[model samples]
Target: MSLTPLNEDLGVLRFITAGSVDDGKSTLIGRLLYDSKSVLTDQLSALSRAKHKRTAGEDIDFSLLTDGLEAEREQGITIDVAYRYFATARRKFIIADTPGHEQYTRNMVTGASTAHAAIILVDATRVTEVDGQTELLAQTKRHSAIVKLLGLQHVIVAINKMDLIDFSEARFNAIRAAYLELAQRLGLQDVRFVPVSALKGDNIVFASEKMPWYQDEPLLDVLESLPVAEQDGELRFPVQLVARQDGSQADDFRGYMGRVESGAIRVGQSLRVLPSNRSATVAEIVGPSGLLDQAFAGQCVTVRLAEDVDVSRGDTFVSTESALQPSRKLGADVCWFDEEPLSPQRKYLLKQATSTVYVRVGSVDTVLDVTTLSHGTDKTTLAMNDIGAVQLSLQKPLAADTYDSHPATGSFVLIDEATHHTVAAGMIRTLAA
Candidate 1:
């Protein structure tokens, strides 16, 4: 299998599924994998046995199929990231199945932070029926709201358990219009809705003939047709190393090495190294298969410059028009993943591109309100799984990209000074002009 690296490669799509309790997110995924013939016979047999046991004196449950944890199985809900991989001819997919309860909102964000798209599952009757689960529909909006804030433009709204409603097209369309309205208000585009019964395997992989009145592509078709996130931007490469591949006689060969973060890289082209604004002409581009005159997104290549200048790791190579300078201070939207709240005065080892520096937390602009999708002005501390915008003052100027411009160079992670644990993932908001 050809592994598409980050830089110019058409790589696998990572997506997540989130829903409220009993919304059938897991069953939807299991049915997708099973109906697509991605499951093993042994696993199917185990499920059969479990199914038999359940039917005889059983609950006829399917949540067992994906609730693969002891606690999750006991509670009958997902609690953490349960990753499953599969592929079709058009693309490969990684599914990060996340829990739906508000308590596991952090887990949902953890799953979604890297996802290219997301599927928010909901039950149809939960919206109309007066019950304790009305909050469930609200929670779906809250979750998708955060996903949009995190920059995900594509969202698939799956209103599942259509069999319970006798496959009413009106019921499905009602929920669909409601979600589309919410999505527009939240600034999310590419929202698609479909009604299905995950338990009965309707409209997941193959179109459900049961819902014949509805004429839309099935969920699998939608996923296959979706655009990949990697193809939406310009090329970026962050230098990870500098090495000398000696000629064995001259001993004076210098080359720049790094994984190409994006775009095509070519040999014999002039590149402007950033932060210093120095220029160099590429003499050769070396890959694992020897020297190639060109490399594209996702290639790890070493480039030899015609004239030797001072170049090192952490320097950025770019097309002349694309060069950007490093900044001594910047703002970031952080997802706090650790137990500790971010201390305003504490220093963290900020890792962005190839540079690491001691950065002080200047101030937290605001903590996002997950429920209302608004800002909490009085909030100063960011707790575990909280998303907030914060500013940082660096000890030295470092090359960076706005997360909106280039994800590779625009993103950074905070390391604990005492334990070295990664406490937060940050998206760079601005760089020096």
Candidate 2:
């Protein structure tokens, strides 16, 4: 397919780069930014003088662009999620350079949570060819599983370091076939494959002359062409705080402040306060600049209700006709982050958007085995980096949607009540009876 830049109306594309250790995830991002002229002069100068130059000769080590931490520089590996923002004439971009180590899977999850797409890099040199079959790295499977779980709109599996293997088409095809099998097992909807050498800049920003067999658009072109997933659904406005004025000149202004999570809210629109199920109307919409006739998803605004109907911080306002109802039981898929195994006996706090409630894991249904791409029902506990399905019993009813439908309201985090540390990132799969 020919390359086409996104129109200005398409908006920004938020994506993340992921793969196993030494798969060139950081290098790929660096190459994208460097070749696209997204890097500033000072940044380029710093790369030239970087103390840990992994590449030989005068070639710039592109990985240094995103590996900003001193530890990352010294170790030559990304430790935390490094985010970079740049714009092209065609589109604006936000790239999250996620760590590849299994130990840092939580960090990867944190980065992928808000991303619209993911680029998974597979090291061509690392793939083991066994009698006409290719074996992929375990981390590749894990990251792809997480992408499916997170419902990323698009996925690009870039076979990197192809230069090491003489840009062999046979090897590329073998790897692609293996990944396709895994993608099928994981039920990933949108996936594409590209052959690239991040270090050599082949098939990254431009098409690679070395690999003539690959006729598709380069990595950058594919990204620009990929549609930015729009947040579509009914109005979901979670009240973050209640804005009130007590002064005489303020005319008793009472506004519920929060970002519209999904859909749009307009003036005079009828809304229902969740949990309480009280009715109200949008009297006015206040934006950062001033009054706004309407507000859409991702915009932070204060909504003045036509009537005071017992709204407070953590309460949600939805379309009056919305089918969403308060429920105390929920079924969810979670990626455990803590070293401590999940204990159903213990109480944990579930924080979803503005609402926080005490919750208990009622049952550990199944745990995913990334190596086999299968779920094991015998597993009763989830260790760090393990993805599992669990049933939760909440102390109070919560208004939520399934993660696949509305991510902003459907996602949540589990916190250790004693340590106050986040333990697991969860996605609601079903609203239990």
Candidate 3:
């Protein structure tokens, strides 16, 4: 009847499983959830009653657990991002199951933006041996590149459906060697390869007896062992709301409510209000339980300023020692998502944190060919799912950070004024000096 609250004490690993179509992303997640006893009895019963048949030939379709959308189930492809949360004795996990289709590459970008790790699935059957060299699928390389572009340091290349390959160690080795080359080319720092059979639960939650030669930790163990990426950066708090308590002077309070995007906040700290350039001191840190002395990243709290120095939603409270500079023009890396192509003539809404401003596409510098990891010749318009380097001119100045600096402040989304749909996701690369 109710959802279980996220256990912060247990530590959460936010990761995504992404690959080409039919690579068993949803099934892998389903196996992790089902085998780990995270699924309930009624859900299991519902699986039994489902009409969709799986190749595994059991009464239940494991993909049913994650492929909740009718369109996804019908097409047998993931179109939108499916987020699932599960926990084990050692750690809790938030898994983003992303689409594998090239048309939905933006969905992969969206899912991986906040993830600490990425499990890029590769179908063992798709591995081709050409003159003693392994050739990888384009989708696999695209997903891996996008994962790195999004700044995910920890990557797991899961070669799924190993059972189909007869659990061949040679096949796994070839794929691993080829992937290591790709990882090196992409500058991926941490990558691990694992052989899994999501359909039959091989090397998923437990070791598969079928492949005793592959002596690495199971997928669950790798996930459980990975250290949750530490949130470290300058203090940046984008105010979402300014709460005001009315009725009595005795309880009169003005609290700025927002989540700590990065760094830490504490009582009696000097805070700087961005754009407006006003300064204030932190008088109190109010949390759900009571007043606290300090708060870290990811904790949403209400902060009472020592002085009312003109603040509201869309304003940011940052560390006075180091603050972000406000700018009107920004250079960014954009992942275009709309069906309609992006052009310089179009006017859209740019939303970063709590701030939304009118913006126009200044120029298309380079359109990246994800397959080859090179820039294409097109510099005019960005097509659907195209990654491009673009310049944006904003009507109002905003305090922005480079994507490499802090993801929370560096990331933004572009909204079409007419359709109100998010047209693109952008990561700031540079701010006009």
Candidate 1 error regions (>4 Å): 1-12, 49-66, 128-138, 232-235, 245-249
What lDDT does each candidate get?
A: 0.79, 0.93, 0.88
Sorted by lDDT (best first), the order is 2, 3, 1
For all predictions, the C-alpha RMSD in Å is 4.7, 1.6, 4.0
lDDT of 3 by residue, 228-323 (tens): 668698898999998999846877889999999999999999989987889899999999999999999899999999896899888888889984
Clashing pairs in 2: none
Kindly list the per-residue Cα lDDT of model 1 for residues 221-246, writing each as its tens digit. Answer: 78776778563345566788988666
- Of candidate 3, the 10-residue stretch with the lowest lDDT total is 1-10
Instruction: Give the alpha carbon lDDT tens digit for every residue of 1-433 in model 2.
Output: 5446345556789999999999999999999998999889998888888889898877899999999899999998899999999877778899999999999999999999999999999999999977767899999999999999999999999999999999999999999999999998889888999999999999999999999999899998888878886998899998999987884674898888999999999999999999889999889999999999999999999999888689888899999989999989999999999999999889999999999999999999999998888899998889999999999999998998899999999999999999999999999999964
TM-score versus the correct structure, for each prediction: 0.87, 0.97, 0.92
> Best candidate per TM-score, number?
2
C-alpha lDDT (0 to 100) for residue 261 of candidate 1: 83
Model 3: residues with Cα > 4 Å off, grouped in runs = 1-10, 56-59, 130-132, 246-252
